[model samples]
Target: MNILVTGGAGYVGSKLVPKLLEKGFHVRVLDWFLFDDNIFKDLKTDKLELIKGDLRNSSIIKKCMQGIDIVIHLGCLSNDPSCDLDEELTKSINLDAGINIIKEAKKNKVTRFINASSASVYGIKDENNVTESSKLEPITLYAKYKADLEEFLHSQASEDFSPVSLRPATVCGYAPRLRLDLTVNILTYHAVTNNKIVVYGGEQKRPNIHIDDLVNIYLLLIDAPKEKIHNQVFNAGFQNYKVIEIANLIKSVLGPDKIKIQITEDNDHRSYHISSEKIKNTFNFSSQFDIKDAVLDLAKAFENDLVKNPNDSKYRNVKHILENEDFINNKILG
Candidate 1:
């Protein structure tokens, strides 16, 4: 099967694209190469095709849909701060461009369309666990767009076209295109590089998944029967941890004495625990890696110098967008 992975050079996509190729699926990547153009440079596979273009361009998106059997749509201005940086650009990419991709996929006779949604769509839930059917309370522009796209995807699902939305947890662990902005990753980076980390409003709970497990869930969806997942929404989260708990985990992994944790107060209180029981009960799928495992993996990566500069703005999406005025004007605005 020929699969098209939009944003295939991104944090999760860098890990996922190679796995799809290993599974013998001919993969084509559509991305603007905003972060790192050489993310897949060492993947010596004939089944890989790279298209360096933005998803907002209808012409580029149409060209990407050619001969595509499955569409793994992961392209967007991912995360809250990044989306907040430019709401117009975020809507253009995450909502408008996403709709264009789905419409083109249906037109091109694509069998499966898997959307990479976020658990943040269930923003600031109460003490109860948020399921797929729970009321969506998107607090950020990013989460709102994902929720909108999820609704739009359900509307587009048909007998011939199967659309599945996977509301994935905040992904942790190392990827080829490494990201340091995520909670676990940022804490780990500070523990390794600075020997200290700060926890702001550390009691807020957040759902998390190992990057590998998150990638595997997408793989499973590719092989799952259409009848089972068609027009269905599933949350793909494994573990839930408070911000302080995650900081402690990093401290334990790197060495308690080697790292210092300082708790601070912050007004940003976005917290939610998602339940993946529906997907587990229906498809027999569950995450294998836990928070400790993810922490260790990142620690090993830092120790091996795999991630040379974790403090670089390029590794942090929000920082990169904020600092680079030209990127905002030329790449995002244009």
Candidate 2:
């Protein structure tokens, strides 16, 4: 099997590519290598190929689509603030470029196209546990783009070509491209390094999954029955907890003396607790990592300085890096 993974040098991609190569799949990574190529430079796999190009480049995408069996589209203008930085660029990459990929993949007769969706699509709801059937109420540009593209991908799938969207929850786990911006990892890093955690909107409910579990779901969708995966969108969260609860859990792992929790009442337009019963039942998938383990592992990574000095820009400034034009341009071309 030959798989093309967009953003394959990223946090999830760096990890997923190795797994794919280990399982005997010839892997081709299409990435901008925004910060540097140093992140995946050490991957000593003979089957791994890197294509540094932009997604909007139809010519390059056409070349990538040739003879590829599966398309794992993980490249995008992720996060609300980043989209807000440049809406036109975000739409082009997140929505327009994605449609182009689908069109070219279908033309190339690609077997499977797995889209990386987000739970943010179900925006600002007070519901306890949201399901796949729930109506979308996207409050951010990032969420809106995800929801719109999901519909677009579903409408484009045929019998021979399958398209599935995994609305993964807030992913937390150690990776070659470690991200300190995520809630779990950020809190753990702060606890381990700074001995402090300042939180806001403690009442907000959010669902989460380990980065390891999230990537496994991508692999699972590949071999899942056609009737089971085609045009199907499933929430990919393992557990749910209030914001305060999560902070307390981090405190438990880092010890009371190592952390301080300060909460403020700030109502954000992004809040939704997701449910994963649909995917679990449909594909017989279950999460092996939980919050307790995630916290412990993240603390260990921080203590060892594994993610301390990243070679790439994605883990640089969680805020600035996400909203950087240089990063977006790199993703488009790679």
Highest lDDT against the true fold, candidate: 1
Runs in model 2 deviating more than 4 A are: 310-313, 316-334
Question: lDDT, candidate 2, residue 39?
Answer: 76
Across residues 1-334, which tens digit of lDDT does each residue of candidate 1 receive?
9999998999999999999999999999998877888999999988999998878888888888999999999988898999998788788889998999999999999989999999988878885689988899898999999999999988998899999999998999999899999989888888888899999989888889999998889998999888889999999888888999999988987898879999999987767788999989988886789888878998899889898676778899988877867557636422
lDDT of 2 by residue, 1-334 (tens): 8999987887788779888888889988887765457777777987988998888889999999888999999987666776887778889988999999999999999979999989999886777789999999888899999999999999988889899998988888788777767888777777776778778887777789998898788889877878898888999998787778889999977797758898777866356788899998987888998888889888777678777564344574346455566764544443
Local distance difference test, per candidate?
0.89, 0.82
- Which pairs, if any, clash in model 1? none
Q: What TM-score should be assigned to candidate 2?
A: 0.93
Query: Any runs in candidate 1 off by more than 4 Å, and if so which?
Result: 323-326, 330-334
